[model samples]
Target: MPSPSPILLAPMEGLLDFVLRDVLTRIGGVDRCVSEFIRITGTVLPDRVFLRYVPELLNGSRTPAGTPVRPQLLGSDAACLADNAAALARLQPEGVDLNFGCPANIVNRHGGGAALLDTPEALFDIVRAVRAAVPAHLPVSAKMRLGVRDASLALENARALAEAGACELVVHARTKTDGYRPPAYWELIAAIREAVAIPVVANGEIWTVADAQRCRELSGCQALMLGRGAVADPGLAWAIRAADGQAVSGAVGWTELLPQLDAFWRIISHHFPGRQRVGRLKQWLNLLRRRHPEAEAAFMEIRTLTDPAAVDAWMARQRA
Candidate 1:
């Protein structure tokens, strides 16, 4: 029998920040997490910039739940990214991950993220440079999509990253053109896995235990990285593990999630300003409604709330 695969928490830039990472990891079952990408432009960023994006660096690069978080860097400049990676390595992160998969228009227009897929050689240079900059003991991993417009160069891009010293790869299973649509082509991930020597993790459109099973079967990858699905259902990782015969608890229902929601509210309230606090809670509640019917009612209750005190009152009512 093969060993059970590691389940990773994906880096979702505005959606999943340090606060949510803390909340979800506390719910248990995620093996590791990648912090939201810290965009590297033409200059090397300071340690504070990396810390701002991944405060886990200050906690020995692990969340409060002790789950390791590898910071991800997104940019097109090989030299600048390497310099920043070297600076980030000085803080002694668990590892560094490159982002070649973001589909955001602003990111692609800047010659970063999914746009790099159009030029596999650039991917190779970026990875090779960062790999050389970071210490040998620290792993250099990467995440990428099939391509900007299609899956034509998926295997070539995967091979380029692996050959350039990326220790692992996460394939999002969709192109920039796909843009979070249905029917993520898991079969294409299988081919990329066969072409690469390092471990490959399957990602994109996995929302349930059944989806997890089918993706693993089709992609032939034991590992997976959960994104929107995990946000919608925080218990997803544990549920998937339970289905895999692991000695873990099963799916977390609405009642069990209430306290986690409260904890999330408290953190955001303290860290974010009034408007942002409301927006962040609404953002999460919006996604949670997909998995929990109760969230729909909860969302409606607070949909009209624009003041922080009113949101607090709403939270208090939920607790009551």
Candidate 2:
């Protein structure tokens, strides 16, 4: 078979701020990045929100380091979604990603996100509405989990997205009921892939290059989308591209690690302006904690450090 394509980074709300996005992209492995969902409830999302989440639009679809970054929108109202999509298209971001897949309860309770799966007709309506509004050349895609409570409606829902003009559909395999807790059913992704003719991207449970390889073979997907896995190992897509069985092995050096961490802090620091630096770093450090068990000591060491001076001092001590 031809070489496997590069992996796309699945956006995590709050977790994927401009700082983290920049840091990860500069690490040189992520294929494409999606901005955190610009929530569009019934109101059209403001251009500032779109620009804030997807600065890559200003940089020609690439992250600060030049990796493609697509803007994503979350909303239920079809016309509002279409209008926001049209406005966002003005920036020429890669494409608009409709988030019918987010299973967050707050989003679901609002009759948006995965709750739309309960009414696949509505899902089709949103997809069709947005697809029709976007320029003919621009691509539109939808991301979704299996369904509300079970797999019974997964195929039908997947097909609806395709029939409604989604250029591609990325399926997370498990139902919304499964949420992030995994044992992600790649078989279901395979089922969805087979159910629709549009390119299907498999997501979930892809923690390592080996898992991605196996998932690609199992799901028979046109591409793979990495979520927490990429967050845990920033070099994941690079390692997978190299096809090294030990791609999961540490390619990140301590020296390289600091710069990326600094970059993340820089963006957070910029956003929060008056907010405490230690607190900013701590949020990312929490996610980074999942990868480095030793980060427990690091978190404890810096937990109380609020300002930049304290944060700088704490890091200095840790390095020493």
Candidate 3:
């Protein structure tokens, strides 16, 4: 039988930085990850910015756990995006991804991100320019929503990206206006798959192994990307693999999970200090609470704490 479709860790800005990417991919079953976009604005970004967003690039573009990391760029100017893509390419990243799907009001208002979806021609131009700028061998991809305000242009946008030389496409299954409200319109993905020649990866609202199977069946996609769900349940991808008749990895209970949390704390502490690190931990725990009642209780205990080392002590006590 053919290998099971790969499960990718979706890029959630402000949340899925190198620390989370390393931690989650280390848990197993993630095939790869995309960096939280590096905004191109009107000029090429400095090299340090790329390094900061995707440090793995310096180490062969793979996370410490060995999953490949694709560096993504977001901007509206075709030439500018292409320029930045070329600069990122020089870093020898595993791949390049273009972002046409950010839903933040600030991004859209600035004529970047999902705003480009309003004009498919602009999307095609940007992707085409970047495609031509990068060498032929490197795989280029795009991630987009159904549309800015509706799903009317879903197929057109998908076609635009493919025709522009995007090797793969990931559809978030919601309109920009939908803003993650769910019922991800998986059916629309099937139509998009039919319209595009390249591979389609389904994303959005996938919360369980059952959900993953249902998304594959409904969207006719060959691969899947997990965002909040992966953060909530780190074992989600492995569970999906096991359900597909693959060998199962061991499960992670709260006891096993606490160490991973501690690892995350240590990783963040290396970069952030004091209350900043504690705040980052709270952000992760808030997401983890969805899957682990233990996380919810732990969050309540540390949510008000201000010191980073103090929070680490609390976690160490729990682990003990």
How high is each candidate's TM-score? 0.98, 0.91, 0.97
Winner by TM-score between candidate 3 and candidate 2: 3
The list of candidate 2 runs beyond 4 A from truth reads 1-4, 244-250, 273-277, 316-320
* Candidate 3 structure quality by residue, lDDT tens digits, 1-320: 22468788898899999999998988878888999998888978889999999999988999998889999999888999899889888989888999999999999998988888989999999999999999888989999999999988888899999999999999999989999897898878999999989988999999988889889899998699999999999888888888888887677667767778989988888988788888899998998999899999999999889976688689789778
For model 3, the superposed segments whose C-alpha errors exceed 4 Å read 1-3
The TM-score of predicted model 2 comes to: 0.91
lDDT per residue, candidate 2, 196-302, as tens digits? 98888889888887888888888987488887787777766766776744244447644567767766665666677534556667876776677666555677777
Q: Write the residue-wise lDDT of candidate 1 on 1-320 in tens digits.
A: 22369999999989999999999999978899999999998888888889889999999999999999999999999999999999999999989999999999999999999999999999999999999998899999999999999999999999999999999999999999998899899989999999989999999999999999999999999999999999999999989988888887656999989999999999998899999999999999999999999999999999888899998888898899
| Error at 240, model 3, angstroms | 0.8
The prediction achieving the highest TM-score against the true structure is 1
Using lDDT, give the best candidate's number.
1
Whole-model Cα lDDT per candidate? 0.94, 0.79, 0.89
